[model samples]
Structures are given as C-alpha cells and as structure tokens.
Target: MNAESSVGAQPTASAPKRFALPSPARRALLRAGLTGAAAVGVSTALGAASASATPTTTSRNRPGTPDEALRELAVGNRRWRTFRQRHPHESPAVRQSLTSGQEPFAVVLGCIDSRVPPELVFDQGLGDLMTVRSAGEVLDEAVLGSVAYGVLELDIPLVMVLGHQSCGAVKAAVAADESGESLPAHIQYIADRIAPNIDRTKEGDARVDATIDANVRAVRAALAAEPDLAAKIATGELAVVGARYELSDQRVHRLA
Candidate 1:
C-alpha cells in the first residue's frame, strides 16, 4: 500500500535498471565466440601436425643418392675395421620407426658363407641393405630377379657383388676341376657355377683368391647386363660394383 501511494512520485531508481541483451542475442554472441575459438584451435593443431610430419619424412627417406649410400658403407666399414662399430639403427626406436616403411639404399650380393654376412661386413644395421646370397655370389635367374626387384622397385642405387677370401665354394670347384671328381646333388650346381671362373685362374696358392675375385666380377657383370638393371645403369641411376671381404683383417677392399 505504501508503494502504491507513490504512483505520482518517481519509483526508486532501482539501480538504474541495468540493461540486458535479449536471449537470442546472447546465444548468438556465445556461438560467435565459440566459433572463433574453434578456428584458432584447428589452425594451431594443423601447424603442429605439419611441424611433426616433416622430420619423419626426412628421417625415413635418408641416404637418397648412390654416392651417399656408398659413402655410408665406406664409413661404416671403417668403423668395423677399427672395431668401433656404432651398430646404428637397431634400437627400439629405430625398429618402431621402420615399422612404417623401409628405404634401403644398396643391394648386396654376397656369399652364403656364415663368416661373411654383408650387414656385418659393411657395418650396417637393419633396413640398410637388400642382401641376396648364394654360393660364391653366383647369379642365376632367381638371384637376378631379386637384384632386379631391389633396383627397379625399391629404387636401390647400388649393387655390390661381395666375395671373400678362401671361399669354400670356389675351392670345391677347383678341387672338382683338378681331380675330375663330381660334386654330388645340388652341391654340384654350386660347383658348376663356380667351375668356369676358377678355370680362368692359374693353379697356385692364390688360385682360390683369384677365382673369388673373378667370380665377383662375373656376377657384377651379369647384374649389369640384366635388362632391368641395365636400363638403370645406362641412365646413371645405378652402379654395379665388386668388392672383397678379407677374412684376415676384417676389411673390405673394392675390386677393380
């Protein structure tokens, strides 16, 4: 009743009647703020994603050129020769990294001898090489296919035919050739493949070594003439090289 009596008088200011936006206007304002914040968040996330992706690409695609691949092998072999092998690319992180894909740089054709594993001789680690082995580095259709796959599909730039000192395969061939004794079973296949190369060498203490080198060169030449590999070599996109692993010094010497 006391308030109604003040109808003629101005009502108490009531804190100056605070102004308020309508409900729809407030909702619109809230939506605009959220949209701007979401856009900022998306931009930041994309920038971070791009920053993270680049290094992984570079790391996965390293040793891009043939010369670089050869140099890496040379440096790794030096470490092995000095007994300072870093034994790189074998950690858990490296294993996980390679789970995505492999980018081997070279294809190594070595002997089946346990003493001359190409990875150890080159001081390389997992995913560093595509290794194909046979008795005396012999090249048959299967071997050629493997080598060609590496060159043509994987884009491997180097193929090394690696022979070693005192190869038993070469010695068997030499013995069979000298004594006219036939090697039995599939062992004969190895001996036959190696026989012609040994026949080109002089009969002496160095005959086995000569034959080993000759076999390496022969395989290298064979690989070079492979139609698929030859095209790559002709374009200077690949190199076929012969090298020898010396058992005495644990050293690799490139053959001429």
Candidate 2:
C-alpha cells in the first residue's frame, strides 16, 4: 500500500504560465520541473534515499499464511534492492472490490521510522499488511489495542515486531538508564518498560543494533505474555515473530 497516499494529493502553487511557450510543450516542461522539484523536496525533507532511482515500495492484498507473508516481503525486498519493482496494481476495480471489505495478511508492530516502512520493506501491495508503529516499537495500551484489532477483527495470523539498527528511541532509553536522568513523564514510562530488557542485554556493548535486536525479542515475549494474546497463541491461532532491519544491506533478519 502507498502509505503516503493516505495524505492524497494536494494542489501546489501553479507554475507560472508560459506565455510564449506552446501549451503542450509548456505543460510537459512544467511537469518535468515539478518532478525534479519533488525529488529535491523529498530528499531534503526525508533523506538521501528518497532521491534514489529505487521505486517506492507498496503492497497489494494481504498474504494468506505467515510463511507466505514472509515470502511476499522477501520478494519485495529483492525487487527493492535490485531496483526491479513491479508496477503497482491499484485500479478502479481493486479499489471498488476492497471498498466493502479488507482482509490484510499480516500485522506488523514496527518503529515509526520512515526508512523502515513495513509495506515497502516487504514489497506488499495495498491492503496486504496491517501495520502499527511507535518509537522503539514500544508497547502501550493503545498500541496493544491496534494489534488486537488486526488479530481479532482483521484475523491476521502473523504479527511481526520489526526493529532496526541505529534506532534513536532505543538509544535514548539506554542512555537515560545509564545516566540516571529522569525522562519525561510519558517517556519515563517507556524507558522503564524497556530498561529491563536493556539490563538483560550484554555488557560493554558498543553497537545500538544489538539493542534493537534484543528489543524486538523482548517485545515479542512481552506480547506473548499478555493474557489477551497468550490464549490465541495456545490455540495456534496466532504467531508473533521478531525481526531486525539492517540499514546498510536493506534486509530483515527474523529473530523469532
């Protein structure tokens, strides 16, 4: 799915009309200029990768099984890494067909990082994935409710907690505990929740990637431990998987 499409299109300032230029030529040139301007704007606003030739990622219908969900994502990543993305499948028919119902395949709990979009990383099309995001992929009441909706209402069988390298949220939590600095009231709650997992983490760790991985595992265990979801696991109606993303390689390694 094109998450960006959630914003839909907005009319920008109209380009100065080309008085002497012919209508067709002027329109083509104007569109080209806007595309270039957009490229620059996105790169500056988001990051360098936004300017690259890599086709932006999107998802279609949700996959059926957990393994199938995983495979679909893997294929998407392959296309992304190799710059061979398939054209999007959205059309009037697909939109109209989904208007009455939506059956997403997988539910993902992930960080609110723009770079690690679940649909893009997994290369899923529209309606293919149900995603919940927060800083550090932290679990809170609201986040839990979102996950529950995906599982109970959407009937998504696989829920993946996707963490990633160089996570700013996890780093802040680690630093807060190490320095004994009191975090903000709400942030303090998050730090407290994640602090134990940090303690269980190895000593003398230099890389934040390790903490990111550990946090994914910790969140998965915590989710499973919740009485609300534990019952579903017992009946084999749901599976919770953990994964970490590699920033350099653009890959997701499953932890659970």
Candidate 3:
C-alpha cells in the first residue's frame, strides 16, 4: 500500500508480462543440446579410427622383410582356402595409392594354368605381388629378366615358384617324351623345358605329378643361383621357396 501511494496518481499498469521456461524444461533442453554435440564428437572419433584401420599400399607401410611378406601371403591363402578371403587392396583408394609407385613384397613365378592364377590363389590384390607365368612354370630369358627386375631393382624379398597339381603342361611334356612325338614349334619349346623335369621311371599321372614338383624345385634353385639373387640370399635379404597348389583342395603346400 505504501508503494502504491508513492507511484504517480494515475494507476501504474502492471510490469510488462514475462514468460520463462520451467527449471526442469530448461534442463531438458540443455541436456538435449549436449547429447547432440557428444554424438557429433563420437562420430568424428570413429571416422578417424576407421581411417587408421584401413590398410594403405605405400612403400613405407609395405612388409619390411621376406618373412613378413611370406606371412601375409600365408594368411591370405588361409583365407582363400577357408572361403573367407578379404580381397584386400582392390578398392579405388588402393588403386590411386599405387599411382605414384609400387612396392611388391613377393615375386610369384607360377604356371600359366588358368585355375592357378597367383593373385586369386594368394588372395592378394593389385600392387602386392610381381607375378610371372609360363607353361609348367618354365623360365625363359624374358621371364628370368622380369623376375630379376623384381628382385634386383624392385627389391622384392620373396620369390615363390608355384606349381599346381594335374598340370596340363606337365602331362603334355610327359606324353611328348613317351611317344617321341614332336609338338608344334612353340609348343615344343615349352615341352622341351618341362620334359627334363619328368621322372621317366614314374608312369601315367605319377610321372606328371613328379614333373610338376620337380619343375617348381628346379626353378627355385635356378632363381636362387642367379648372381644378383644369390647375393641377396647369402645376405638373408631374399628367399626362394617352392610351393604347390592343389586344385582339388584349394590349398598351397610349401615344397621347400
């Protein structure tokens, strides 16, 4: 009453109307904002982690030693054998990463048999392996040069001579040797290279199988003996191994 009397004679209107949220409502709004912000932060962190987890195909990140390279191949083959292949390094990003250069870990000299394609059998994608193929894993000047380049120039650590079971080239070579039959000019060249690997004492499929295994070992020995490669082997910087792929079981068995 005293305050009212002090005001001007004309009755003062009530203070301007005001509105405010309830305390609980205000807290709810604040919590919602904080939750949204936290979600954004979590998303960013997860994105970074995902990026880090993906493999990169750069030289710095490539396998550093022959054992490391061989381990990768073995794991990949295990996946392939188990039907769980990850099929790594085939994405667009992987392809782009290789534009600058390549650091293949291994050189695979395999048969030209379609079923034994090195990339598929090993479950490796592009830029992971330097592959050379010839009938019955035969090595010619060009093939040897290619492998040499991978070793001497590119510094590939592992050289794998991959043979396969039930190889046609081996069978043909066995036939040519047994029948004294002369194959066509180019075919004869392949047969000639493969014939020496066959064991004449073994007959039929036994002879063919023996030839395939012998061919792989012979090629590995030859590569290991190469002057440039020999130094690397002696220094423990390179390894030459023979492996055989079984078509029926889809497995790779190391022969040496």
Query: What C-alpha lDDT values do all the predictions have?
Result: 0.70, 0.66, 0.73
lDDT string, candidate 1, 57-149, tens digits = 327455766567667777888888889988778998876665445678889999999999878877888778889999888777677766765
Off by over 4 Å in 1: 1-61, 199-201
Query: Model 2 reaches what TM-score against the true structure?
Result: 0.70
**Residue 217 lDDT in candidate 1:** 71
Task: Summing lDDT over every window of 10 consecutive residues in candidate 1, give the lowest-scoring window.
Answer: 1-10
TM-score of each: 0.75, 0.70, 0.76
- Candidate 3 lDDT, 106-191, residue by residue in tens: 89999889999989888998888899999988887778867876776567888888999999988888899999999877999989
**Cα-based lDDT at residue 129, candidate 2:** 73
Which scores better on TM-score, 2 or 3?
3
After superposition, candidate 3 runs with Cα above 4 Å error = 1-60
Error of 2 at 146 (Å): 0.7
**Candidates sorted by TM-score, descending order?**
3, 1, 2
